[model samples]
Target chain A: MKKYNNIADKLVKSSIANPERIYNYLLYISAAFFSVLIIFPFYFLFVVSITPQHGLAEVRYLPTGFQWENYIDTLEIVPLHQYILNSIIIATITTVFVLIVASLAGYVFGRFKFKGRGVLLVAFLIITYFPGTTYIIPLFRLFTGNISLFGLATPDLYGTPWPVVLPLAGITLPLATFILTVFYSRIPDGLEDAARIEGCTRIGALFRVIVPLSAPAVATVGILTFILVYNEFFFSFLLTDSSYNNWAPLVHGIQMYEVTTVRGSPYHLMAAGSILGLIPVTVLVFLGQKKIVSGLTAGALKE
Target chain B: MGDVILENIVKQYEDVTAVENINLNIKDGEFICLVGPSGCGKSTTLETIAGLTKPTSGEITVADREVTYLPPKDRQIAMVFQNIALFPHMNVHDNISFGLRLRNFDSKEVKKRVENAAEILQIKEILDRMPDELSGGQQQRVAIGRAIVRDPEVFLMDEPLANLDAKLRVHMRTELQRLHKELGTTIIYVTHDQAEAMTMADRIAVLNKGELQQIAPPLKCYNEPANQFVASFIGSPSMNFIEGKIRSGGFESTHINVDINIGNYDDLSIGDPITLGVRPEDVYPKSNSPEIQSQSDPIDAQVDVLEPMGDEIFVYLRLNVGAEDGPTVTETSSADQLLMSVDPDSDVSTKDNIELVIDREKLHLFESGNGNAITHGIGEQTALNQNR
Candidate 1:
């Protein structure tokens, strides 16, 4: 009994001494389980998309028959090519516009102090959570008929891509400005002082020192804006006409076609469409994963 | 190269006057150091000279050109910050070449200067490594190398050695002095450490509350501090202060009931109060030593704490009769902490009562209320009084 107690105590001591190893092992297993849980839905989507239209009814977890026909059928039923073009244009324009305007506003807000700056920042944050419907009527009126301000008329903006793209860019600007501002502020003040001492003008320092050092942060913001623009639906649905119909806008096409009203709906087709739409964005995020992680956590840990 | 001068330089930020009426003449090729405690405005004065900060009023001249309004780069000066400020993304070579590139220096000239500076700093092998890859000392050397490549008329360093460890800081202190000799350039260094200023500068400027207390060679500042502030600040184990009233040919202490003779200054009236200053090194433990006995009866203090450093032991003691109100047992308990440096080999320890004698000539005198030194030259005195 004494020997057994000594052995038990030794085992417990060793386990306690290296608790981190045991904790890490448990973490690895947990990660494996969570990965499977997340990937299962994606696997189901893939299998359903490939399954023949007739075979899908009997299908449970996996595809029964390999029929490329479903893809062709789905493509023919909707204006897929035109919708893809519109999505590319909108996402590209929104991301580019957001990044440019956000970085400019972010630099000013981050590096300078002026009266009402805090109030302006708080106002932006408050508006962030307010419903977009509240602003829609006012925006529509402004675009339809120019409002005069200080003896100048605001430019007429009707039925143009500017109405959709510009509004999306403006909506994204505030938060992007806040994020980039924080990133900019966290850069060591020594760097700017050194640049100024090195004969760099304020603009020169921003370009030569601040910009190069901010590459990772810039990449992070760009990827996030791209994802936000790619996945947006409500604004695209409300603002777009026949000429502006994007792939996200086509999600409404299902409603007009009497698909959403049917009982026990053809969800397999809708799921297939949703899965296809995620491909481009997934590719982009995967390519920029490292930069995104580094940029977001840049200010988190420091010496 | 032209001499630099600050004329009635004043910097005010809202209610705080960071620097006030500082007048200085920095000769060409002179290495000057600004040393002071925190909030003393040594850094503010340096920044104002560098054009990194604009004075609220007054003018600064560098290389004979009035540059108070000029930008830092146009001032033909370079500054090495306390943090070093190396470009982390670039290697040492590129960091050195950046300024030259901005000025559109020839590619060949840029490479030659970069290589030369790297060789001088002995960082030639690590030229390809980014700043983050190097150790603190190496990064510091690289920072200096970057400055060397610019070859500016004046090099300003704001406590560059502060980030280094004690051992490395001492080593680099000598290295910097050697570099200054070889380069023969005017340099302005800022630090709160008197030892750094003493070791590296041809002259030292001590500041307090944005005012220049004194500017002189290290020894001169030490031997002849312009005011009570400089006397106390410029030494380790700081100079000890004793407050008393001037008596006939001596100083009379209310608590101790003892008097110290002041040869000629005894003519100072009996009612006038004054501060008597003495450096720890100038005060000795024995009345028998010829230097100690020359003064009448030496001041007596009881030992409190003895700190033994390798070369010297610091003896902290309290005057048995201390403060003004009474025998001041409580105040004496706190004021009992007087530091005196003795040879480390001495057998003295705590609890031993010791006599402290001041070298009369070395003793400093100041008006009790205003801590200014009583010096002659009424002409210079007018300017001094105006600053006050």
Candidate 2:
């Protein structure tokens, strides 16, 4: 019994001396807790997506039956593939557009000093504070040719993807600009000056030195804008008609499954459609995961 | 073939002048150093010469071509920054060859130049390594290699070794001097360290408050400073200054009980206020040094502090210290204190009373009104004296 107590005391003393053991256990526990908190909803979504239509209301953690046909049925009931393609096109266009415009604006805002620079930057910040709904009605009227600018009739864009794409791009632009500006400003001025002295033009320096150094930041902004536009529901719902031909996005296609079926509302089909809609963004975030994490942490730390 | 001349360069930044009416005639193959304290516009002057910053009014000619309004790329010059701005995304070879590649040099020429620069800077082993993978000294060598590969007519370095440790800094100083000898390019170096300027420069331009104080060879600036500022700025442990008036016989101070016969100054009138300047090494213990001719009259002082610096001992002596109730030394003031350097082997301790004499042959006199030098080596009657 004395030897056993000595062994116990040694274990306690060693653990006390190295608090990393306790901290490691605490870290694992908290990490597992948060992981469950974050991933349970996706797990539930998957379970419901594979559940039969009649079994969704049952009180169960697991699916009652595996119905892989729900995905096919969701596709048949609503044109989800066409909507996904449309979302791909719109999100790509908006990401490219925002990346180009935001990087240039960020470069200007980050590097140059001029009159009213602060005021203009604050103006961009202020634009981010307003909800998208505040401008949705006017934007809808504008896209429908009811609202005109400078006595000219606005182009009718209600049935097309422009209405959704333009508003989403406009709404996401300021935040992307802010991220890129903060990132670009953190790059030392010496690099640009060195490039200029090394026979590069100002724009040449931007492309060769600044852009390559800003790859992680550009990826951060690109992934963020792409995901935001891809998963957007409000603009897609209000901007286009209820037809896949009108280039309605995946979110709108999923929302169409709320119609009453023979059993009840087809929420399982909606869950299946939602899971299908998550593929592109999931792949994107996975591929650029390293850059996104580093970019965010780099922005947080003061040089 | 790279000789740079700056004609009346002035840079005004709205409310402040960074550098004013600066003129420099840097010769071909000259290693000129712009040395001054921080905010002294030394870097501004270098920038104007490199065409990085345009002068408000000036003409900068490099290799006999006027490049006043031209961009940095068109100026036929390359620069090394104090931060050692190696392109972080590129390896050493790519960084060194950035200029050559930008000018659309063929792959063969670019590789040859990059390899040549790597060999010159002794950074050939780091050619495949990224900047972050190298140490600070290696990064600085890569930056220098970048400048060298450009083969521009002129090279500008802005305190390139400032970020290195002391030993590395000293090592790079010798390396840079070797590079200058090998390339024979007109190199303009800017640093706030007087030692770096004195050791590496063919000519040193000292600036203060946006104005050029003196531009001369290093030893000339040391032995004969143009003004009181240069006298104080150039030397280590700086020159000691005493505010006094020139009497009929010599110089006398009001705060301290000290008098020195600075000979007859033709430029100075009787009863005129002048400042006497002497370096720490010029002050000798009177009894020990009998070889110092033309010495001032001995003044009684008490040693306050002794700092042994391995090779030499810096003795801080307090003047007017006979009575116990005499003025005590204050941390904020150094008016009544004189610093003297003695040989390391000499025996000296704090609180010991000693007699100190200034070497009259190395004494400097300046006008108290304008802080301009009146004369250096003021003990001899035949010494050159100028009134300005």
Quick one: best DockQ, which candidate? 2
Where model 2 places Cα greater than 4 Å from the true spot, the runs are A1-37, A51-60, A72-79, A111-119, A146-151, A200-216, A242-245, A255-269, A293-303, B51-56, B254-266, B285-310, B318-335, B344-358, B379-388
Could you say which candidate leads in TM-score? 2
Scored by lDDT, the top model is: 2
Q: Backbone collision count in every prediction?
A: 2, 0
Worst 10 residues of 2 chain B by lDDT: B379-388
| Worst lDDT 10-window in candidate 2 chain A | A294-303
Which ten-residue region of model 1 chain A has the weakest summed lDDT? A294-303
| Per-chain TM-score of candidate 2, chain B | 0.95
Q: Identify the runs in model 1 with alpha carbons over 4 angstroms from their true place.
A: A1-41, A52-60, A69-86, A107-117, A144-159, A203-217, A237-240, A244-277, A293-303, B104-106, B254-268, B285-288, B291-310, B316-356, B375-388
Q: lDDT per residue, candidate 1, B1-388, as tens digits? A: 8478999999998799999999999999999999999999999999999887899999999998999999888988888889888876677788778888888999999989988998888999998887777888898898898888989999999999998899999999999999999999999999999999998999999999999989999999988888889988998879877787877544566433224333334335677787777777766777334644334345677777788889888887777644454234456543344567787877777767677765555767777787887531111112222343
User: What TM-score would chain B receive for each of the candidates shown?
Assistant: 0.90, 0.95
Candidate 2, which CAPRI tier?
acceptable
**DockQ, in order, for the candidates?**
0.28, 0.32
Residue pairs with colliding backbones in model 2 are: none
What tier of docking accuracy does candidate 1 attain? acceptable
